[model samples]
Target chain A: MKVPCAIVGSGNIGTDLMYKLRRSPVLDLVLVAGIDPASDGLRRARGLGIEATVRGIEPILEDPASYPIVFEATSAWVHRQNAPRLEEAGARVVDLTPAKLGPLVVPPVNLDVHLGAPNVNLITCGGQATVPIVAAVARVAPVPYAEIVSTVASRSAGPGTRQNIDEFTKTTSSALAEVGGADTGKAIMILNPAEPPILMRNTVFCALGEGYDADAVAGSIVAMVDEVAAYVPGYRLKADPVFERDTYTTPGGTVPARVVVLLEVEGAGDYFPPYAGNLDIMTASAVRVGESLARELWRAAGLSERDGARDGARDGARA
Target chain B: MSASGKTGEGGRPAFRLTDSTLRDGSHAVAHRFTREQVRTVVAALDRAGVPVIEVTHGDGLGGSSFNYGFSATDEMELVREAVATATRAKIAVLMLPGIGVKEDINRVAEVGATVARIATHCTEADISEQHIKLAKSLGMEAVGFLMMAHMIEPGRLLEQARLMESYGADCVYVVDSAGAMTIDDARRRVAALRAGLSIQVGLHAHNNLSLAVANSLAALEEGADQLDGCTTGLGAGAGNCPTELLVAVCAKSGIETGIDPLRMMDAAEEAVRPIRPDQGVIDRDAIVLGYAGVYGSFLLHSKRAAERYGVDAKDILLELGRRKMVGGQEDMIIDVALELARERAG
Candidate 1:
């Protein structure tokens, strides 16, 4: 049987998740829940013939058996309240907000490690864009300080993003340390209002300690970009990593061996325009996590791989 | 030649002109401005009675790295030359908080950069607090630049501008970095900022949509105190507002700018115009970029990406606008072009 999933928000990220979920073979998106009756997202979901509700999570709360997995794209404050309720009802949760209530997950870096957790938090967009590069650099060298600057189109930044600016920087920086394996991390976001809005560009500055292999670090970063590209096809490097032998003057003193890498994420025009790589990376990774979780649940239950596909086929035949 | 400040209905102040020939004008010359070139532009602008002359790489201070092309000469050397040559105009440096740090500010200030334009994305003004404070501490006139102002509503822009004002900015600018705003957009934002902040408000415009001059005038009528321009509209994308044109307009409108329009025209035609790669005019790429509300700096990057990916540049710009991409997302050009090429291939 195909795993039934419900998306618990009908914003850009949630609606994008619904479209990607349609392409997944393992999970079926049954309902989209939101509080806004006249939202474009709700209209789009209804147009797609999915059961969408403006009553928020009540629909899913009442019919827990129908939704075994839930994707919470609401704000952190909302998720903080809804997560426990979903867990009580025996539904797995993928929290897409900056809520750190669950174990942090980045599909390419550490998704598999938190598979069994009741709730998994996909960090902020900046975290999704830069942490992998930090992880890739840390794989080869001990990164003492890693700083990421993410510049996205201002139009791509929604009201939620504007209000949560502080939380985004704090969460992304923390994820850089906890998940990206950095001693200290700093995150800065720039919303470019340039016409033909600029694509999502990320600049990664990693301070490598002595006795580190530069070539190995480059190789690892390339490999990691490919890994992320598996899900986000537009994720690629603008140029080879640039290295400078310079001293960084900190509040304490000076540090050496600074390597800077520039990355650009082009979204796969799924639901957002291709320039919304920030949104793309988040939703794309969520799909990766959802599909993997679906497969994991199937295996644990001794269900065959073809069983889910067969169920989807039977559903399509019935429809 | 009108240096007289004719009072408005409510005695609103006249606009101050900031000549950006050495800074934004670099894009017109492919960011290869020599120290002598900067000195020449600075001297002429100062002699023409422009009050402020911004000098830095086209992308701002510390933007001379590989990602944003390497300058023909070092920026510090150029700053020194500008300081040595300008007679009356205050020297300024544009510093995005991350790209240009405290040390960069100190270096420029030490060499006599009297104004520091601390720029950040419109919604992220909090990040500019430190830089703005540092500029004030250094005794430099600090201006907050809310880049991509078209991306937010007037109330939101006012909030960001208030944060900059709270952080010690003497003036706050509504920067149309993409030249995408209509006259009403500029008027609404300037009016909001005027009502909200006690500090002075400025306007910066790009000519991507052929509305730079009109938007600047709109903002001026709505209580803008400072305006930025480049000689001959020689800057990024379709370039900035033409300095001579703005001065001429101010004169015609009986609003004093203390600038000689004839001198500005001489500077544009005799000095800056010869070195320009192409005169600033609204082309197809620039038009689409303006219509789609894309960043102005992405024009060249988009064109190159389109050529490399074998797709139409307009298609790339339209797709970028559809996605609501911003200034630093140059990499998406290639992604959009590739996607377009793929669709054609299939």
Candidate 2:
């Protein structure tokens, strides 16, 4: 029994998420909602035979129990307005915006902790790409400072991304500290306009505390990249993480050792082009979180995994 | 030349001057501008009839970080000092969209910064909309700054500038951040903006190709309403157009700038020259910055990386230019240098 899921705001992100949800085994995409009647995303969803609405989140609100999960792919401002209403309707929200209405979840790092959360905030594209690596290093040794620079192609940045550039930096930075286990964090984003738009690139810099084992840090980072790649197939390290004894001056004091990780994310070409890895990683992570939430819901209702699969097979046979 | 005859009251050219010694010059000095230096410079520029004085980190607000070098004194402290010292000049601050945020704008506004020059890469003006609107909402004059303007053609640049204008930018600038534009490059861009934009058009030139003043003259001939300069040309790369020289030239060319050239010269020599003894010379690395079409702020960082990695700084610059690196990608300097070193070893 795949739980029903809906996506709000049929913009670039929402449209992309629609394509990714088609491949999910545990979640069924029921609705694609947007306020604009002439939205291409809603039209595309309808063409795919999926129910889409022009009434925004009202369709999900009218029959809230039908949608056990909803992905909010709208702007931060719009998500803030829709979050409380969605919660009142008892729908689990996987917020793709930087609204930060609930606990932040980077799937590999803290999805288990926030499994029962009513709303799980995927911080930003930059946060999703770099936080796991920061968490990996933090797991090996204390991270005094972590900074990230996310450069994406200009063509991939729609109006929503452009408007939330500030939120992207702030939310990503805080997630680096709170979820990535850094004492202080900073984030920078760049919109590169090179012709034949460049792939999404991120550089993660972490200042390590004293007595850090280099081998342990490297092993942890490689393992984390594999775990993230299990969902985001195109996510990979550009090269080995560079470890050096470099000095970093933070607001607190100087940090002795540093680790630099370079990452490139190529989209799976679900809806957008391959250069839009920034969007791909977000939707992929949201799907992973939604599936986890669905399993949790089944458990809470006293149904085992084998029983749910048997019921899904029986329902398929009936159809 | 006929456009040079356009004048405001008192027979002065209808042009405003913004001195950037305290802001862009920070990059040349490694972001080590003390509060006293800001005070002295702001006081001198204010007394010399400079209409505006911009003070901030070279990379703008929230720029003090591990990627970009940290400021010696807090940028807010420097902003406060500049605001307190300036009596006649309106204080301005630079806010790159991705490097800085709305909170940075609010903080600068609270400290009496009346003008917010919101900057972005030449092709990415769409990202400046929110910040520009925020600045205008805070009752600050928002200027759209297009850095590295040579990377795009005039028609496309006009389209980007139009986005800023629609977002409530009071003025827009044609910034040669890499000091790479020729005189015609500067002219066509300023002409395109002046012809297209209803808002004011400004030109910011760097002297890497030895064309900062020539390009400023071309912009003036094309009806540019504003021009930026640094006292003694103390800025990144080959520095900016020297304020003292620009004023003296304007005074001699029968163009009225409403600025006392002698006072400006006094400010440059007495206030700014002592800070950097060999300021603004178009040396080899500075020339390479223009030749490679790389960012001006990358000059110092590239040199440091080259020295540490035992590779050529010019090679690092050319590679960065080849990669089409933008303003906020300063972290790539070390990455590029490391790759070059590895290649050399291999």
Which has the greatest lDDT?
Answer: 2
Off by over 4 Å in 2: A35-37, A55-65, A244-247, A306-319, B1-14
Q: Candidates' DockQ values?
A: 0.09, 0.66
TM-score of chain B of 1: 0.93
**Mind giving the per-residue lDDT tens digits that candidate 2 earns over A1-319?**
8778999989888999999887776777889999898899999999999998989889889999999899999978999999999999999999998889999999999999999889999999999999999999999898888999999999988887787788889889999999999998989999999988889999998887778899999999999999999999999988788876756666646877788898999999988999999999999999999989988888888989877767755654543
Candidate 2, residues B164-184, lDDT tens digits: the string is 999999999999999999999
Top candidate, metric DockQ = 2
Which regions of candidate 1 fall more than 4 Å away from where they truly are? A1-222, A225-319, B1-13
Cα-based lDDT for every prediction: 0.82, 0.91
Give, for candidate 1 chain B, the lowest lDDT window spanning 10 residues: B1-10
The per-candidate count of clashes, in order, stands at 15, 0
State how far residue A76 of model 1 sits from its true place (Å). Answer: 22
The 10-residue segment of model 2 chain B with minimum total lDDT is: B1-10
